[model samples]
Target: MADYKSGDTASWDFEQVRRSQSNSPARRSQSGGSGRRTQDSQPPANRRRRKKRHFNVVTYILFVLVTSAILAGVGWLLINDLCAFNKEDITATIEVTADDTIGSIADKLHDAGLIEYKWFFRLFATVADAKDKIGTGTYELSTEMDYRALIVGMHNSSGNLNSDTVRVTIPEGYTVSQIIKLLAENGVNTEENLLEAAKTATFDYDYIDNNSEDISRLEGYLFPDTYDFYLNEKASSALNRLIKNFNSKLDEEKLAQAEARGYDLQDIITIASLIEKETDGTDQANIASVIYNRLEGPGDKGGTYGMLQIDASLLYALPDHTGPITNEDKQVDSKYNLYKYAGLPPTPIANPGLASIEAALDPADTNYYYYALGKDGKHHFSSTLAEHNAFLNSGDYAG
Candidate 1:
C-alpha cells in the first residue's frame, strides 16, 4: 500500500511538469514545425535588419527618380532662357542703382520685356563671371538686341547715359536755317536760342574766320551729319560740333586743288550748293560743267546764253514760295535771282554734301550749257538755248 501511494505522487508531479512545458513560448516553437509563426522562424535581429534594408532601398530609388525629374526640369528651363527665341522691338532706359546686384539687374531686364527669364539671367551671369562687371548708371537698352548683345552692351559702363541725350540726324543739303528748325524739333535746343547762336556766335573755323562778319557764311560749311546732343544743350556748343565736323571732313589737299582751278573756297561752295539743288548725286558732275560753261561764255559750246536761269535760286529768294516759279515769280527783287544777275547766287541757297563739293572741284569736261528736267527724273543737257527750249516742249520732259 506504501509503494502505490509513492507512485501516485510521482506520477502527479510528472504530469504537472509536462503541462507547464507545453504552455511555455519556447516549447510551443519547438513542438510544431509547419505551424510556427513566420517571424518566430528567424532570429529577431536578422528579421529586423532585412525589413530595414528593404525600406532603405525603396526610399533610395524614389529619391533618385524625384531628384532626376527636378534636375531635368531645371535644365530645360535654363536652356530655354539662354536661347534667343523671344525677340521684341522695345526701347527702354533702365536706371541701375549703385546697390543693385546681378539678380536685381535680371529682374529689371525681365520687367522691361527685354529678357524672358530673370533667374536664368542671374545664373548665366554667375557662371560667366560677369556678375560683378556691371556698371551703375542709366543704360539705353533696346529689345531689338539679342540676349548676349544686351548683356555686352550693359557691361562695364558701355551704354551708360550719364546725362539726358537726344539724337539728331541731319540729312544732306540741309541749310543753316533748316538745321536750326531741326534742333528745335529734336528737343536739343529752343528755336530762338539756336537761331540767335547761329546768327551771332563766331566760330573758330578757317572757313568761318575768313568771312567772319557774315553770319550766313558757314551756311554750306556746317557739314550735314548725325549728332548726339545733350538735352537743352547750349546753342554755341551744338553749332561748334557741326563746324568742327565740317573742318574735319574737308581735306586740305582738295581745298588746294579747288584754289588752283581759278576758284576760291567760297566759289567752290557756291557752285557745289547750286549743283546740289540742280540734280541728284548721279548727275552732279555734268551739271557742274554746265554752270562753268555758262559762266565762261562764247569760248565754250554755249553761245551767248549768259543767264543762269536757276529756278532753285529764284525759290530761295522768295521764302514763302512752295511750288514751281511762274513768269511773274521770276521778277522777284533779289540779287539771288540768277535770271537777272547772270552769275552765281549771292550766297549758297542750301548746304551741299561731299559728293556735290567733290563734283564742283572736278567738273565733267562737257560743253553742256543748258539742262532741263526730263520725264525719267534725269537732266537732258544741251549746248544751246534753242535745243533746251525744244526739249522742254517735247514729250520727254514732264515739267
Candidate 2:
C-alpha cells in the first residue's frame, strides 16, 4: 500500500526485524545464568563457615584432655610417694651421741631397725627442715610410730639412759657407821672405802676436835633420813650427800637453842642419848627432869657421889652383853657405866631425836630423887631413900 525509498527499505527490512526479535530470548538466557553463579558462591561461603566451627570443636576437646591428664599425673605422684611414709616396728635402743649430725642419727635409726629406708627419713627431714632440730639423748623407739612421729619425738628429747636407778632413803637417826654398813649391804660402796671416806672426810669433824687424838668418827651427828643415790655412787659421794642432808636439817635456830641452854652441843647430845635409852613413853621430859635432879642432888655413897648407877649405862659397859641385864653385870666397873663414872658417858650411845634433845635441855620441874618402873609400865617416884627402898622391896615392879 506504500511506495518505499531505498534508505527507508534499508532501515525497515523484514528479515532484520525477525532476527532482532529472536536475540531478545538469547539476552534473557544470559541474565538467568548470572543468578546460577550467585547461588554457587553462596554454597562456597557456607562450607567455609562449617570448616571454622569444626576446627573450634577439635581445639576444645584437646584442651580438656590435656588438663585431665595433668591432674591425674599429680594425683598418682602424691599417692605413691608422700602418703606412704611410716615408722618401722622394732625393739631397739637408739643412743644418740651428743651433738650428733642428722646423717649420723639417720644411720643409727637405720641400724636400730627403726626406719625402713634411711633416705626416706632424710627426705622427710629435708622437707620439714628439721636437721638441727633433732635432740641428742637416749631414745626408746617403737615401730608403731609413723616416721613423722619419730621425728617429732627426737625433737622433743623425751628419753633418758639412767631410767632404772636404785633409790635409797637414809632415814633420820642413822649413824655414819650404820650408813656405811647400809651402803655396803646395798652394793653402793665397799666397806673399806666407806670407812676410809668417813675417816678422812670433813663430815666427821662434829664428833672429834681438830687437835684431839681421835681423827674422824661420826656417831650421833649423822642425821637420819631417807636418801637417794645411784647404785654406782662412790662411798665418798654417799658420805658427802649425808653430810649435806645433816647441814640442811640442822638449822641455826636449833643450834641457838642448844647454846642458850647451859649445856654445850656435845653435852646436850649426851643427855639426849641417855634420855632416849631410859624412856619409851611421851613423858620423856619428866624422866629427863629426874636425871637432872639426880645430877644436882647429893651423891649415893661418898667422895663427891661418884656413881650414877644407871642400869642402862652398866649394860653398855659389858663386853658380851646381848640380852636383858642381870643383877651381876651391874657390878662390872667401866667408865661407860654411869654407876662407875661421875658424869655423862664419853660420847652419845645412839642418835637422839630433836624431841629428846629438847627434853634434855628443858626438863620438867620436880623434886623426886629415885624412880622405878611399875608392873603397868609407869614410874614410881620418891624423895627419900627410905621411900625408894620400900618401893623397891614391895616387888610391885616385877616386870
Candidate 3:
C-alpha cells in the first residue's frame, strides 16, 4: 500500500523510482537503442552557435558580390561604348587571307580604326557564326558600317551594294560559256581575257579533274549563285572566287554521305545535272529515283539495261542545237550520248543547283525505272516497260 503511489510509481524508494522512469515510453523514445540524441535534443547554446555560423557565411558571400558588382558597372559602361559606337568617318582597306583567324582579323580591324576592342570582335564573330563565313578577300570598308555590315562587306562574295562592286547572278544549269558570257556582259572582265584564263589558268582545287583537254574544262565546277564582283576584276580571280564558294558547300558530312551511297562528289554532280535537264523542278526527286533505279538495272534489279537514255546529255555537245530529241539523233557518235553509253557522262553536262544536287543525293523511295513528261507539265513515272509504253501511247496525259 505504501509503494502504491496512487497505484503509480510516484513512490519514495529512489532506486525503484529511477528504474521505472528508464522503462517509460518517452524515455525510451529519446534514448533510442544506444541513447543517441537528435538535433532537437541538442543544447540550446550549441544550436544557436551553429545557426550564427551559417548566417555569417551567407552574409559574407552577399557582401563580396555587392562590392564586385559596383566595380563592374564602371567597366560595363566603357565596354558598351566601345562595342556599340565608333568615331571617324574615314575608309579603311582590310585584307583577309584564306588562312586568317578571327584574332588576326580583329587585329586588322582595330589597326584600321574600325573597332576599339579586339576581344569583343572575336566574341561577336564566334556567336554570329561569322568565324567560317568570312572568306579571303580585300574589302574597302567605311567606318559608318556597323558590326554586322562589316562582316557582310568582308564576305568573299555577296550582293552588298557598294562602290566598286557589280552584282551578277549565274543561273542554274548554265554552261561554262554562258556563265563567262554573262560575267563579261556585266563588265566584270573582258570576254577575251576570261576565255584565255579558262584555257590556261591553273586552279589548285583537288576536285577539278585536269586530265580533260576540253576547252570548257571548268564546265560544271562553277557554282551558280549571286555574287558582287569588283568592276574590271581579273578573270582568274573571279573564276576562283566562284569555285571556292562551290567547294565550301561540300562539307565533310555531305562527302561522307556521298561515299556511303557508293558515289563521289563528281558522280553526284553528274547525276544532278541530268536531273536538272530532264524535267521541270516539280518531279526532280521522282526523276532522281527513276534514274537510280535504271542505273541499278539491266536485270530484275535495274530494268533499263544499264543505259541512262537521256536526251539532254546529247544536246550538251551541240551548243546551238535545240528542240526535242529525234530517233535519228540518238545515233550521234559522242560520249555525251547516254543512249549509246552505259555509265555516267565524261563530266557533268551543266552546273546543277542545290535542289537538284539534294535530290540526286536523297532520291524518293520508289519502284519507278521510267518517267515521261506528261501534257500537264509533270513527269509520270512507271515501274514496268508495259506500263511505261501504255502511258506513252495512250496520250491521255492531260491529268
lDDT by residue for model 2 over 1-399, one digit each (tens)? Answer: 889798888877877986676467664466575534344435567889999999999999999999999989865644333343343347667776655767787798778766656676777888874553354456676666666766655652313343233556654344456667787787655778678766765443454453432312455555566666544344555666555554565546655775775557777677776777677557668777777767766655132353456666665556367877766776567777776567777776656666676687778888666778888777787766778778888978644
Worst 10 residues of 1 by lDDT: 155-164
TM-scores for every candidate against the unseen true structure: 0.57, 0.50, 0.60
Cα-based RMSD of candidate 2: 26.3
Off by over 4 Å in 2: 1-176, 204-216, 247-261, 300-306, 331-333, 378-380
- Candidate 1 lDDT by residue in tens digits, 173-266: 8878888899889876688877877777867666575445455676787788788876565576677778777777676787898788677877
Q: After superposition, how far is residue 257 of candidate 3 from its true place, in Å?
A: 3.0
Residue 120 local lDDT, model 2: 69
- Ten residues in a row with the worst lDDT in model 2? 156-165
lDDT of 3 by residue, 238-349 (tens): 8887888887776578668878978888888899889988868877899888888877755464345768888888999766787767777888888999888877888899
TM-score of 2: 0.50
lDDT value, residue 38 of candidate 1: 59
Q: Which residue segments of model 1 deviate by more than 4 Å?
A: 1-162, 209-215, 299-306
Better of 1 and 2 by lDDT: 1
Lowest lDDT 10-residue stretch of candidate 3: 155-164
**Count of clashes in candidate 3:** 1
Overall lDDT per candidate, in order of appearance: 0.77, 0.63, 0.78
